[model samples]
Target: MSMTANTAMAASTPRRGSSIAWSDVLLNIYILIFFLYLFVPLLIMIGAAFNVNSTPSITDWQGFTLDWFTGEVDEETGRVIAKGLPQEDRFLQGLWHSVIIALGVVAIAIPLGLSGALVLTRLQSGSTTFLYTLLISPILTPGIVLGVTTMIFWRDIFSVEAGLFTTMIAHSTFIASYCMLMFMARLQRQDRGLEEAALDLGASNVMVFRRITLPFLRPTILTAAVIGFLQSMENYNTTFFAIGGSWTLVTEIGSRMRFGLTPVINAIGVIFIVITVVAAVAWVFFRKREKG
Candidate 1:
């Protein structure tokens, strides 16, 4: 009887192993599919950047050239030999505008968000919920609505026409809410006893906030600023309506798509990809060092 039971148990162990192996194979297939879905387009885009084709495409293999990035011009006639990023003055200007707006958004959003978060976290009252909802309503509002309203309000009230200034304001209207949420999350986990003790020890409210609270919230502030900047850079609908004739890098890209598609766009994408990858790698290394 003991030998029969041992043989049965051994057979069941092999059956379980086979099942586990099959599941592993399925999981691997799913992972492969997901990665392909993400990277195949990126690979195609990168390939097209190096292609000599006037139009950006990987289907028709053009001869490889770096003209899209470095550009080409006939020195004798001063004619465009190969249109490149340097020749795209509007695109370059738009990129500069995007950086400026992003910086402005970060500047405006961080302070407003920090104020809202501080109030919501520290002020214990029934009205806190109402105030929180009011502050965050801008985020829930449609981008179109925000854009139109911001444009009209500034133009009517402040005599400010739609431009980078209005665009920054529109972006901040929603981005501040995002920053506030990040700040609030950080504040919720804070040890309030330290603040209380500091106050009891004759520290002024401002001193306690500067030394204790600000130090604790520093990470969230940096994170919120980054998020706000990225949000401002990528925003299209709100920016489009609020900016009027002004444009950002994203808007310029969209405009180019309407008239003609070029490898320069692909070059821009590749540059962005490289920057993002480098930043991510740097962050990983920094985090590892921090942990160590």
Candidate 2:
């Protein structure tokens, strides 16, 4: 009887294994297709960047040239001129401007977001709901509307020039809302007992926060900061309205597209992709190390 039962169990095990294998195969195929759909355009763009002759015509392959990285072609003279034309550094300058603005946004957003999140966490039922709605309202507001309102507000109230400063403020207003939301969500899952115990042990409010809350919230804060920075850097609609005459990497690329598309843009895109991928990989490895 025992031998017969063992044979039946062994036969059932093969069926279960086959089902799991089939599920895994289907899941892997789905993931492969999804990744292909997401990455194919980026792959094509990166490939085109290395093409010596990048043209407006996607179908027509001009023999590969590195001229776009080097210099611009003169339209009237029909000569490959290297002087008095915008080159790599011009694009880099715009990228630098974006970085500066993004950094500013992060600087302003993190403290405000963390404070707001902490306050909201302590609030009672009625005030909590109202505060939550107010905090999140900015994220829900349309970017175009926020940009226009910011432009109007700054112009009317402060009489400030519409430029990088205004653009940073505009981006920060909405991006900070997102940061607050991210931090608040993370804070909800946190153990507040450490904070209470620290306070009970006669620690000052500031000390309790510094020793217990801040360290605990550091990862969420960092995540929110990165998200805010990326949002500020890539923002177009708000930046467009608030930028006035100032140019950013996004604006420069958009403006230059009218004259002709160049491989330099692709080069820039590839660089961005590579940097982001490396950062993501490093983050994963660091996270694993921390867990270990």
Candidate 3:
């Protein structure tokens, strides 16, 4: 009986191993498929940027060239044969506009968000729930409605035309909620004892906040600023209606898509990808170095 049981157990071991191996193989295939789905289009876009084709295409590769970055040069006359990213004045302007709007959104959103977070977190009131709901309502509101309402509000109330300012305002409306959430999360983790101790030691409320509260919230503020900037930069629907005659880099890209796509757009994507990768790498290294 012992001999028979030993043989049976040994036989079952191989079957278990085989099942485990098959599951691992299936998992690996799934991961491969997922990664391929995620990155294949990005790889195609990057490839298209180098292709000499006028239109953005990976399959119809004319030849590898840097004409997208630097305009096709007329060798004889030394003049531009075709417009490139550098020569695309409107796109460049739009990029500049995006940067400006992002900065403005960050500036506006961070302060408003901080204020809201402070009110909700510090004030012990029954109305806090209502106030919290009201403050966060903008985030739930549709971008189109926000854009249209913002445009109309400015035009009707202050006679301010929809432009970069309106676009910035529209972005800030919802972005502020994002910032507030970040601030609140940071605030929740804060040690209230320090503030209480400082106050007990005869420190003014302003001084306690400036020294303790502000220092604790610094990292969250930086994070919020970055998030706000990114949100403002990528915003489309709200910007489209609020911007009136103006345009940002994203909106300009959308407009171009309607007309026709170009390798310049791919070049832009590649540049952003490179920047994002570099930033991520730098952040990792910085964190490791700090830890070390």
Off by over 4 Å in 3: 1-21, 75-78, 283-292
Candidates' RMSD to native: 5.7, 5.8, 6.2
TM-score of 2: 0.79
Candidate 1 residue-wise lDDT, 137-160, digit = tens: 998999999999999999999999
lDDT of 2 by residue, 79-152 (tens): 76642124555667878888988999999888888788878987777778888898888889988888888888
Off by over 4 Å in 2: 1-33, 56-59, 65-67, 70-89, 284-292
All candidates' TM-scores?
Answer: 0.88, 0.79, 0.87
Tens-digit lDDT string for candidate 3 (14-56): 7686778789899999999999999999999999999998888
Number of the top-ranking candidate, with lDDT as the measure: 1
| CA lDDT, candidate 2, residue 204 | 100
Better of 1 and 2 by TM-score: 1
Residue pairs in candidate 3 whose N, alpha carbon or C atoms collide under 3 angstroms: none
Worst 10 residues of 1 by lDDT: 12-21
